[model samples]
Target chain A: MAESTKKKKKGGRKKSDAEMEVKAEEASEQADVSEETTDQEAIAAESAGDETTDEGDNQVAAPKRPDPDWQKAEKPDLSLDERLQGLEEDQLRQMMKDMLLARRFEEKAAEAYALGKIGGFCHLYIGQEAVVTGAVHAQTPDDYVMTAYREHAHALQVGMEPGVVMAELFGKETGCSRGKGGSMHMFDKERNYLGGHGIVGGQVPLALGVAWAIKYRKEERVMQVYMGEAAVNQGAFHESLNMAALWGLPVVFIVENNRFGMGTAWERASSLYDISQKSKAYAMPGRVADGMDVLDMYRVTKEAVDRAREDSGPTLIEARTYRFVGHSMSDPVHGVYRTKEDVEEHKEQKDPIRLFADVLDEAGIVSQEELEEMDDEAKRISAESVEFADEAPDPEPSALYEDVYANEDVNGRLYFDGRERP
Target chain B: MAEITYREALNQALAEEMERDPDVFLMGEEVGVYNGAYKVSKGLLDRFGEMRVVDTPITELGFTGLGVGSAMVGLRPVIEFMTYNFSILAFDQVVNSAAKLLSMSGGQFPIPITFRGPTGAALQLSAQHSQALEAMYAHFPGIKVVVPGTPADAKGLLKTSIRDDDPVAFFEGEMLYNIKGEVPEDEDFTIPLGVAEVKNEGSDVSIITHGKMVHVALQAAGKLAEDEVSAEVLDLRCLRPLDTDAILATVAKTNRVVILEEGWPYGGISTTLTTLIQEEAFDHLDAPILRVTQADVPMPYAKGLEKLAKPSVERVVEQVNKVLYR
Candidate 1:
């Protein structure tokens, strides 16, 4: 059985002409060489017994696989134009702007992190913009959104001001978390964005609680939680899924399958490559979306959100996506586990922003000049946010004692360390 | 006031709070249909229905996080851990999510959630089930830790915990559940957290404690009275918002102190009180503070070893006598 033929059968769609052009551009010899390199590296690294105790060891090699195989895994049909139907021109333009804004914001964040303006583990959402933006497009402002540490894009998508998000990175009082919660914890209660929880799969159960509240209150709201593919291995993920399905709660579980959990590939870390299939154990409908295509992501997420709001129960969506950057600011873009060629191919062929822009252009929904203007506008907003964060005041030293308890007056002495309060 | 068991007091508090506020709901293992593992939620399912009194699968971490999440969204959720030992399974959600959510979110969300469960040794339930976890919980800054030793305190403190806009870790005494005491009849009867009560007043020495240890301290105080050495018994109902003024007052009055706790001596609440007394009221103390704590080892299953492991009235009395320089 040929691998390409198998993928075609599972995809259930013939390749579009544009896809064929990109495929023809990739030399077959280059793919073969990268496959050989991956196998040799995996075997050599395994035999050497190279184990690292370093916490920043994002260079660990994943289990060997032919480089092209995981890339050709099944995805939604590529007729992104179909997804543009029933949407007004303004909505499509907003979606484009939102994705661009996320990309531009992260680019600025990466720059700030390099200049020592941001501290702590800053995980940028550079390449995975479409996944969150499209999912947000499917949600109402009243609906809740929660995700793991890689959530700058999720914050922007859920309508958090870029200035506040940047200020959070800068640890300013004006940050969404009031300078207390740094890079990994972004929260906006008014926008219904729960937080940027740092722990892996930690936000899923919280999402379940929000969903349970919605069900208990007899409200027609949905709670959507996003996590990386690595979080699928967490016990909380399975436990949350079981309860969400058992109670028929209105929640959507989205696993942004960005191909890598830091350095380890999804295929290397997971026993089963197909993460959506795990949802079967929880008795929920498992759907997969082409995460790079914003329209397809919106379509699948909308269907799940509708089902949940109508009280049909939760849906588990495996949004097949890729991150164009390192796991965090400290890591390299591509090395150790993945080849530079592989990264380049994905960047050229499936860069979510570029792909969406092309779809918009081909469908006549957006002009090239309009897309350029949107990108420039996004850059301006992102650049100004940096200035805002740079000038934002630091939290007052008195703030150290504040917010430890909701009603500290009634709770009595909260700080026991004997630090004098000014 | 009405005579009731500690169990009944907790039940009354849950029922009254749920009845008072529609947002207040109870969730835990065997809480609804099974009427709770310790039957603390008995008749709540029938009274409030399954929606308010929820029965959940044994996913402690999941359900606990769910409760925190619900509390984040303005619902007052009372999550019952079958035992404080089992709460270790949900420790992350308690410490990481529930306790830290307020401070970490920069006070955006106030988690009005209560994690109540039977704590401390009950017969030969062994190490896993018989551990006291108040010290570990009280260590966190954002959470309020309460231990109600008597029926009245159980009803009053629990009502206050549910109403407070902070996450509260309410530790119920497993051995004191069936103990009877007088409880106020008022539905709104509530005790303020972070307040200490003098269970018995004296001036020779002070036996300071909380939770089940309060009874042991009182017993020791009675023994000291017989020996013509008066001892003050102070019960610190809440740990995080510690009654520092009350503790200091007791220290000043007694001039000697003996701290007691059911947890291990190393890093126990006793260690904290001793440090606090020496730091805040050093000149007032006549002798170094002593602590009566569980043996520095895991709880044993055998009767003799288990008895030896726990802090007893004899141990508390011995510590009091030592502090009094007898």
Candidate 2:
């Protein structure tokens, strides 16, 4: 057998050196199988008839065959000049500023969560700014955006005010959801940001439905639905993909593969490490983009958004990125599944905001002083959001009965009339 | 007026709604081309084409969520579930997404969707396929639950359900689909939801029921009249926004009451009606309100066992006799 065909496990270190040595010996022995028998058995297995006659009956069923078509989408490698080719200086500055704003806003949210000002699950979008920022930039205002719980950046990119979003986190009446929905349920009807759905992969089908509505109305709009890598395992994800492809709905499913679903790594949970390739089963084009690079994120998503707008079909784009913080505010930042050193290394080397700043500086689009000022402005806005949330009034007790139904005739009767119990 | 079967009435409602509004569409498993599992959506695909009448894969969660999403953006979607038993697969979407989206989103999105299908036991279909799920769905706050007893009511209520601006679980009794009744020929005919109808009025006893049980109650009432005892039958068309006024007025007239339902006794719709009667018409009642409910067990496949599991005409008469002290 070819040595390359022997599986090599690649991940964390083994707990014991003795165990590693034993595994290596076993792997070497398995790689010594005769090449001729392997080829003959392969031909026999592929043959149409079920013949009981076995030429190499004793040969251990060739270890489960790998998916031959399983190949990762090629990552584009554009030169700095090439990356900056089509981008205007103003647009580049705005994208960098948006990334910076998202980072600063999340940092404030984390601090507020620790201070007990914010409650429920507060998933910070610290290192994944470029994914939402660039994707939002590529789509028109008519486009719809739906995402999972980790969507503070998405809410901001889709034009929800910082104060209203923070106020929602504070559970105040002035919040976008009128304090009914907390951080994970942020919604803006005017902006066409569907929601920050709490259920994992729950919004995939809903997004397709929105796309269906757009197509039904003959509107030239696309729906962009975002989910995590881990959500690909959910049945709704596959169901939605199939329906979208079958109906030719105008939707782009963006999977932000940040490597970890909470503490469980993507490799630990999924058999297909490359989630984008799963789109092939539904007969849709799937692509991968560097999530840390804003320009690349925009370029790939723009193609998808255009295809959808033209009523071609749905596309699945997997954005490769990393999360600098833990899964949510409740999770400790380090020393569990991931180390503190790894977090620091990602922050120092590939922080999306920092990467965008470097690109801006190299292109001489924005100077260091201007970047520092932008950081200060973002900090000011984030601090004001905290103050606004603190000052916002609590929802009235009567507000509890509101919004359950749009038909007012059925609304506002919380209890049975003249009855002691509801 | 025209006499038609319950299935034909439902088909007419879907056809009319599709013709009335371009935004309205029907999608579900076997709803198109295959002509629906129960033939309730028969001829819709041929009439409206594939776009208006969609044939979805057997994905209840996906298609239900899709319906909710479409409704949120100003389209009315009629999503069929083949049967209420299979709707269990889409329970999360129905309860969490469709029902709660309006309230959770602060009224920004109103799900104008109808989840329609056959409910309750049919012949030998047992256990999973035989559940009457009105009590389960009516428990949620934001969604409406409507169960029609006759062909006319089926057509009217279904049209109302589709036109309503909120999510509605329109449950059609599997056993009642073939029953014929006179329905109005008006294209705009729609019975308002949350209203109860007095199918039969009598002076002796009040029998309150919904869906197929309404027929059973009427049969029991007929038998009681043969014995010189009069009985009134009140059909509750909608379960969620229950018609308390109609219930109270019926109790006032008859002075004695018996509640009948096909669902299990525990936490069933009968339990709610009993509480309402005791609270509002306690002084008018001559005896304690009695309830004839299904046995509290999963429906069995055996014909005898299935008959015992569901409410029967004899059981209703027995409950009425006990309430009347006759």
Candidate 3:
């Protein structure tokens, strides 16, 4: 492995497409073995004139041999499931339900967007639910927060009602932003969440500036700034990191590396695939956590945030995660760019929420029946949110002009009778 | 009750505002320990602590953005660039984020920020540093651009700017900051944005100007006064949301108007004001409106050439006389 790491670093002088294609072909070869076994069963069934119902389980038990070179040393199994090592069975089950609800809510948002009930650029937070819910629970309520456009889970994690979030998505007057920012711009100022910025790399420097104020005003607060891998490639990320490290600003830069950015994979997007190593350029501590694992994200972000509160400067965490859905609803979930097998493998083998439920069941905290009941409870809660948003009122026409300038319409009332607002 | 220079008025206004609001602070290169390049922030660091009075690294973009971000979270930050030429280096932050935040946030955020520094041609500090950008800055909304002429206006308007909910790009005349006038020593005093003052009233010709050029126009009016040509001088305090009523009324009464701007001749404030007066008060004008402005060429660092590049008292006098006689 040491020799291979050396060879990989030495061979890092711009890999050719042929090499990457060769790697992909080798990985698919193992999957071809499974396909071949299924094909053999199909042929046997055709010859026998009766189907082999137990063929899948038979193939799985024949030889448990996974491809050696094709296998990625299974990422220490994303400690989120491990950290629930001994959580009370009932509590663990509830958390898994929260994660399931978050994932379901995101799926519904994608459906809503397709139905034209949601508008603007909607970046789904389906696979990264555990990261938001876990980190949010560890932070103090008064702690300042800000993130880029993929922010539905952040709002939900901070305990915003699903109805208000959906109402904001629908641009209703009852929205957190008063229907001003349809989707990419919703902010709950009362929650200390600055905004859901649309510009790709704009939040880094702004969040750094907030940290400066925290240190300047001597406030016992820290900020969690979320950015995508695409933004980490931008100038603001480097620029803000330099100052944040230089000044010892109270901040935790959470880079949610969800494998693919828009359409490009992480290896295609970043020269340094391991982003934590890039943090050394600014002389700050950078850690990597499995974003799929909620407990792992919570544990690491909590340490970084606590250190920030103690005036220990900044920390960067590169949360390695994946998106279950496409970049936006417009993207094809089963397209040629990604194989269906690759997704099914993650969904079955390493889902953060599913694994947590298994831990709870194994601990006898909640049986399978009890877990199903929690899912039912969450489904009912989510079904009611759609109706609440649909019934939410639209902001008045005058609302368009009201916020342009502060109280700029002192004389505007003279143009009409004061009682005509309705 | 003491008469002070426009520069002293600005210093006093900062001292007062900082004393008044604990959240208010000033930051810029050379603003604190070095007094200021122009001494406009002199004695502030002494009056206020280092936190309230800060000296920043030579980074306009960094400090300007810091001010904007701080303002968003309920801090009042007064950022001074050495001059408007340096301030232009941070134009993207100034224009895109600070000014657009309020409107883009749908009024969720108020940028109670003030960016003040010297503007217009300073003899010998030319070309790189002596450009006027009021027209460039006034081009943006969600920001109020104030170019104060007199000491009274400098103090009052600056106080108003510090208190304004919107970001205010306040201009301190490089040449006229030292010029003296009676600034009312009142605590609760402020001149509203978008209001012009009749610095000197007359009937033959209405001469409009702002910033350092206001002094030049008043001087030109003194010369016109000797020639029995009564020139009314309008000091446009705020350029955006310009007090068109004062300009139109004065232009109609005088029937002749000459607007002087220290910027390059093309698309100067003179062009905007001349077009506005001509369109609004065209029938009342006996002679065509005229504009006296700087030479279109870049201001050379040579003292004599720098003076030649900017609109001067002689140039303002020349334009006013031409408009009045014609």
For residues A60-151, write the lDDT of model 2, one tens digit per residue: 33422212211123434456776774778998998988898899999899889989989988999888888999999999888999999998
Model 1, stretches more than 4 Å misplaced?
Answer: A1-81
Question: What would the per-residue lDDT of candidate 1 be over residues A1-422, giving only the tens digit for each residue?
Answer: 13323434444563322343342232342343334445545566679896533231233223344345343354544455455747788899999999999999999999999999999899988778889989989989999999999999998898899999999999999999999998999999999999989889889899999998998899989999999999999988988999999999999999998888999987678755567757767767777787887887887788788879875489898988888899998899996988898889889888989988988898898999999999999999999999999999999998888888897777456677877896
Instruction: Quote the positional error of residue A308 for candidate 1 in Å.
Output: 0.4
User: Candidate 2 lDDT, tens digit per residue, B168-219?
Assistant: 9999999999999999989999998888899998999999999998999999
Structure candidate 1, residue pairs in collision: none
lDDT score at residue A355, model 1, on the 0-100 scale:
88
> What is candidate 3's CA lDDT for residue A99?
81
TM-score of the A-chain for all models: 0.84, 0.81, 0.76
Kept native contacts, as fractions per model, are: 0.77, 0.57, 0.23
In order, the B-chain TM-scores come to: 0.99, 0.98, 0.96
Q: Name the candidate, 1 or 2, with the larger TM-score value.
A: 1
lDDT of 3 by residue, A127-175 (tens): 7777776676557888877888888878776667888888888888887
Query: lDDT score, residue A190, model 1?
Result: 94
Question: Which candidate leads the pack in DockQ?
Answer: 1
Compared with the true structure, the alpha-carbon lDDT of candidate 3 equals: 0.74
Predicted structure 3, TM vs. truth: 0.80
